[model samples]
Target: MFKGDLTVAAAYLTPAGGAVVTSVSPVGLADRAANEVSFTTSLGFPKKLERILHNPRVSLAYHTREHGFATHSHYVLAQGRAAVDLQPSAQRLAELMDASELFLGRTKRGGVWDWLLREYHQNRVFVDVHPDRIAVWPDLSASGPATVTGAPWPRHPAEQEPPKNGTTPRVPVAKLARQIAALPHRLLAYQGADGHPVILPVTVTGHDETGLRLAASSELLPPGGRRAGFLAHGFQPQCVGVSMRTVTGWLTVEDGRALYAPHTSTGMTAPPNRLVTTVANGLLAKQGLRRAQRNGTTARLHDLAARHRAQGSERQPTAFEDAPAQSTRPQR
Candidate 1:
């Protein structure tokens, strides 16, 4: 039940191999025939796109139902490999207009609308995801077991080895804990056996030298440990003035609880006004584009566009084994 206006939390990994969770706006089932889902971002925000390019495994979690899919108590965690379409030709964008309207409301004409959304629309890059494992919980509370569907769940009896020396909290536990507590939305991201990321909502119950103590369903947290990511944020519509805290570290899940040892911490808080936001986006996009130019990423994106133009299709969806159509969807 992804709708354009519904915001969902998404996760991806950094090149160094740490999970980072963030929010994506207006995601939806972009291709009904293919059963494909996608989210969009601009070239201005190239970092996440770059990360996706490096590693395709990602996840989208739907914990809310307002203005979204069928009203149900189910919470869905969709994990899959993702493909990014760097900004393409104007014709491609034209083809996307109908779907855009379906999720994002109709477009307007004239200069005012143009001025407000110029940066937003100019270099729209779409990230299309083909889910491999979809875990549906009985309720948003994650109180019961999940009804797993799609491709088989890959198991990692012995998760990939941790770093040689092991990881510890880079940011002071007190500071990180304090920051995390201030934000209402807290999510944890960890690498699965298949390298796809698993993300689940968690509560920051407490913290110590080991890491930030987390409270989550044991079923969602693998008992053995692995390096993981933690994100805590708060936002209004469009996430204009969002304030978020992120940390990458070690994750230990056992005894129905979890612990995170943060190896690094970073965060940002932006202004809320659309005018101010657009201005800021323009400036940042300019700088990011310049960096892309210097790194030859600009040409790389153009090459991808050319390839896409030649092929002109998305990643084909796979069947969900024996599950019936209705069962494949999140159930109440």
Candidate 2:
């Protein structure tokens, strides 16, 4: 290969179990002598070459592209090779000015040229491949008119199985959404001052339709400001023959830390108030469905349903006149 060409680079099986094609020369290429027709690398090769050249049977393929057709110009197959010459001690200290210049030219913007040169000096090696046979294959598809073969190039050890979908494991979607909605309360529930609910941040461990399961607490903040207190809220819905309608959890505060109580249980509950019944009745009325007359009790349920539905749609919740007062803990 000549200078100023990127495609003519050499590929080698590295000792550390990988295939590498580097423009960086591990061995000096031009020390062939005054009139010698052959050349070798500066050092022998990486120790990996020991395993690779053990049998001394190898094939090297080269591709030349011209006018949309690739022409194979120089393909050399070699065998029965041995490390014949060690790099001369005198030449070991000797540096190749051309390789140094090539190294400098190879760098891009912002490269530390001197540092790379030093590294190259420490790692470069030279190898001499003894030729047993040589072949030049012009076309790979034709499988015709080719010379030199022992076996295909040894498989590189670095080839790994393509990962399934390029990832080790993946998560499902629907369950993830439910976990997100329930995360805040489940993570932060701890006992607040005077039994008030302190809300904490939550990191979910798992999730499903029922609730988000927790692996860790959400009480990560330091005490101060509006966050000093906690509030608890619960919601439960009831419907005939729908035994699964229930959702409840607690929020709490303790020791300047807030956390959510775990969601340990659930079940359908009767409507919370007369308004709830009124709202349910309104829903039925809007559908033009009236319950059979039963001591006018169904009418009362309808009225209650209407009331609850109206309250539910309020822009801001109305404080219950008999709502439980939040307890305040004494400051330490």
Candidate 3:
């Protein structure tokens, strides 16, 4: 299903136990025998990289839509351990770029490939992921179990070694509440019947010391009560910093509202140094200039660069905390 599509979302755990989900482009997929997937990204070390380095466990989701009289889609979720290869062979990088160009229908010699090659050579890393479990929803409307494969979904590594005694550390619900209130956006990820992960940008309707009240579409809520992943992240461009919080728990729909009982929660942040931020900002400016030239726009590049600088300088920091875990008793 991922053959031609480049868009995919990767979810990984931060040191603080938060899950960071972000959009990524799959440069290439290894053969089933190899049991690995590869993607390429900018050279600068981002927050996601930190999470992956600290914890190799990750989840990757991909889906494709068919539009027409009757809309339909197919989705897959691959839970795996990702290894970041900082020094991949140049030949491998070239092959991946070639595959990306072919999938994008770009000319082999020049065009986007040329620019991508230059960028790849200058700064880029390849992340190879090995799947441990895969779940698929072939049809969205079908009320059936997802086709599951591979090993059972492992609990967060931290959970494996619960404190010496049986008692676990109590999550600070009040702290989390305050953090959620400050977040500008929330993302909810659920598995659709069609075997794909659906990520929705939602608004936090209300929150208390216990849990959060989120506004979500009933369609995204699976029937018979199921769990979903929620993530909230804030970007502070001025300081080139990012903070993210994650929750995994059961979701229920009642009276047109969704109640979330967060089972596990975690949070983390990435604050780059001033030198790194300046370099990144410069890269952003150069990219904008290239885009403007390609689009035949005049002097828009500088404007775009200025806008980025202003947004970075002014955006506020967002804080996040973990939500309290809900009971495992089956929902009625």
Candidate 4:
């Protein structure tokens, strides 16, 4: 089921009763001799690694286009335990890195591969996940339904409790507004027509008191008015800090854009961890520099930071009822 897919969305529990979901590209599946469906990922994502270490229970969702047709997309969600494998032999490490390079369409002779290999040797480790339950949607058409194996499918935590007072709870307008503006990227999680969850990265084009305006490619857009989850995360190197927020609501298509009106929201911030925070920020900076070089431009993190600040300051309050606010320091 994982064939031809470059990346997967991994979700794991946080110490604070919330969850974090992030995308990671798998090097390849583990040996078939193992009784579980396992895949490997690098440890460059310190926060995800730390969370997985603290809570091994995790879920992974992969979406793939069937035969290059967006409308024929299929998805798989696997619930598993993510174990850190720190002591792989040098040969195994080399093999894993080579596989990753191939998956990313990079050749051994490429300068990009050389730089990536150096980074992997310096900061990467492997995470191997053992699936306990698996669900597959072979087609996303309206007639399709998810097929489950290994264990009974579990309902999402958000759906376990009914909304209070016949309406979804609202979050503090300013807090949600700031979070919507500060993060550089947003992740959208929604159920496909086949009734399986699909997660994809999207761009937040605009925001207001009512909701956020999302700009997604036609291929990534879900059915109109579908319930979906939106997540944003940001890190500050100078402060050695990180923040994450998730908002869920109904998404409607209008004027060729998706409008999401948040009903429930949760956010959390981590105390500064100097070493990990610095490493994470440096990795992100290097990636930004590579993208800038490829595009023949000189953009930097500070420039993006300034733009986020300007956007956050201009945010207006929403009309929703007040809710307890989470503290989020401005990114530097």
Which candidate has the top score in lDDT?
1
* Total clashes for model 4: 0
What TM-score should be assigned to candidate 4?
0.50
Name model 3 segments beyond 4 Å from true: 66-72, 105-117, 140-143, 153-282, 285-332
Instruction: Give the per-residue lDDT of model 4 (tens digit) for 1-332.
Output: 44344445666664543344554555344433343334554433445555566556666665533111123255566665555554467886667656655444343345654564454443345666565556655543212456666555544323222233332326554567776576554677664332334455567776766677777655456444555677776544322355667676656765567777777787766556754543454465467445644654323322433453354321111201111111212111
The TM-score values for the models, in the order shown, are 0.81, 0.28, 0.49, 0.50
lDDT against the true structure, each candidate: 0.68, 0.28, 0.51, 0.52
Give the CA lDDT, 0 to 100, for residue 143 in model 1.
60
Tell me the lDDT of candidate 2: 0.28
lDDT: the better of candidates 2 and 3:
3
- At residue 59, candidate 4 shows an lDDT of 65
Give one digit per residue, the lDDT tens place, for model 2 in 1-332.
11111121222332222222211222223211211112233222223234333322221222212111122333222222323222334454354433433322222223443343332333233343333323333332213343433322221112223223331113332433343343122212222221112222234454444333333222223232121111112222211111121122322233534332222232233254534543443343333222223345334434543454354421211111111212212111
Q: What is the lDDT of residue 211 in candidate 3?
A: 57
Candidate 1 lDDT, 86-136, residue by residue in tens: 755788676666555543445555777566555556667878777777777
Error of 4 at 192 (Å): 17
Q: Candidate 4: list runs displaced more than 4 Å.
A: 36-44, 66-73, 107-116, 140-143, 155-208, 212-332
Clash count in backbone of candidate 3: 8
Most TM-score-accurate candidate:
1
> How many angstroms is residue 126 displaced in model 1 relative to the true structure, after the best TM-score fit?
0.6
List residue ranges in candidate 1 displaced over 4 A: 14-17, 27-29, 65-70, 89-117, 301-332
